[model samples]
Target chain A: MKIMHCPLNGPRNISEFAYGGQVEVMPDPHQCSDKDWASYVFYEKNAIGVVKEWWQHSPSSYWFIAERHNASDDILRTYDPSELFSERVDFTTGENEP
Target chain B: MTTGLVSPKRCADSHGDRHNDGLKLHDLSLATRSGVRGVKASEWLIAQSLHQELKTHELQPPELQPNTLVELPGSRLLMALSTREFWLLEPETEAQASPIPSGHCAPGVWPLYNQNSHAWLVLSGEPRAEMMAKLCGVDLRIEAFPVGTVAQTQMALASVVIAHHLWRDEAVFSLFVDQSLADFAWEALQDAMEEFNSVQ
Candidate 1:
């Protein structure tokens, strides 16, 4: 159990956390149905290697980010959960996009 | 025999109030302070320098690894792992409201807060594990959990701190949780132990 420092809540209690996979799997709301939304929200596949996972700070009222190596069971990095939700923008056109 | 009278020894009332004689149950009220505090190596060095009084054989120092359990003298068990680590399971006497001695750390440097908000439930008898498991999610297997071990986890929808202590006559556990959740946890355990004829 390697210690993963969380940016939002420094030094979180590890056991109170549940890993959600690959940080890059953003569902397309336009194409996704209610069932698809439900599955995306509830179900998860425990994949190995560079998987983006969701974690809940159940004890603390804070959301944060973490990176872990599933194959070796090692924690790579952690950051604030809001970091992933930052608004994306087209820097070339100076237009804000998500 | 023809009168169908039951023997006095066989009567239920003759057994007395069994629950009344059991361990006195108290309503624990306290708050939970959560966060990790670092322990300086200097403190460990000082504790080691104290007059070594070896009474009972302490378990061999567990390999320096994550989540390893270390049993110290005076029934003290320490959980070594993570930056915010080391849980001391002192005897019931140690939980009383008293200032812990200083010198392990520089005077007034290390602040130790009173963790009384942790409601402690002392469970004894043979069915302790069974009763506890019904409320907690952790596996309390004997092989996984030996005597003089401590675990921090959730129980009955509440965060719990549990330590197992083995005695010659009976086995026991010291369970702690937030004071606000005490009644909820107590009721949950009692309801789970209903089939076992729990006493107090």
Candidate 2:
């Protein structure tokens, strides 16, 4: 098998993961209702492209938000979920919760 | 310390009957002796010579993908592409003779426990894959999981290691998990399996 060096974890088996869909689309809180928000949270399109998704490192307790091409299954980039959340909300806040 | 063969006190026939009927409880006894001895956990790294009498079959390891099985010569096999790691098996009698390897054998550096405490459910028949898909999240397609492959994942919320032992025109999959979860896992499997009349 061809081993591709993943920028985040280096050479790891691609099989140990589930491709979660593309990134970049926000929930659009301005136009979306609570029902829309809830649906967005639970439902998945399982789409293919430049999408953002959550990856659970089962063996390790690490979670990453990654950007990748859906068709070719090539990961473009990845970042710690905490880092992404920190950018949008206060480190300690009402909704964010410590 | 006792000398010679240390046999645990065997319960009466009444207890044996209860155990056979799935009424009695059995503990995970590492002291349960098998005819063949096990290699020490410390000796995992040292590759011992193959037995002179037994035939050895070397198979090319499958590519790094999900639902892959690697068959060994005898009825034994290894499920290598599982999330947890490898699942080892052998014939019921010879299983005791198989040596347990130690050290970092598979990816993720997960330790391979002897797992003698677990019970196994060996399922066969035409609709085995269909029954599995009801409880597991992984795809159970024959194309996705060719014969001689294994999958280590959760089934019915319990951690399980499964392997497909291929035969001519038929496939058999073995399910191994903690003995504590045996009843729960077995019930869930039976519930799923009951949907198809073909499963008996």
- Taking all chains together, each candidate's TM-score versus the true structure is 0.50, 0.45
lDDT per residue (tens digit) for residues B1-200 in model 1:
01122223222211134643233222222212221224353244235422142123333222223334444554444543332334444432233445544443443224334254456565655455766777765566667667655565667767776666642234556576776776777777656656566343
Candidate 2 lDDT over residue span B1-200, tens digit each = 11211123311111233323111112112222111122221122122222221223433322323345555454444444323233344433222334555544333233444445566665555566766788775556788766666655567767665666763234766676677877787677656755664322
Q: What RMSD does model 1 have? A: 14.0
Give the Cα-based TM-score of candidate 1 against the true structure: 0.50
| Span of ten consecutive residues with least summed lDDT in model 1 chain B | B6-15
Chain A TM-scores, per candidate, are 0.59, 0.56
DockQ for candidate 2, C-alpha atoms: 0.05
Compared with the true structure, the alpha-carbon lDDT of candidate 1 equals 0.50
lDDT of each: 0.50, 0.49
Candidate 2 pairs with clashing backbones? A22-A51, A22-A52, A23-A51, A23-A52, A49-A70, B44-B102, B68-B149, B68-B150, B69-B148, B69-B149
Which residue segments of model 2 deviate by more than 4 Å? A1-98, B1-46, B50-67, B81-85, B94-111, B167-170, B198-200
Candidate 1 docking class:
incorrect
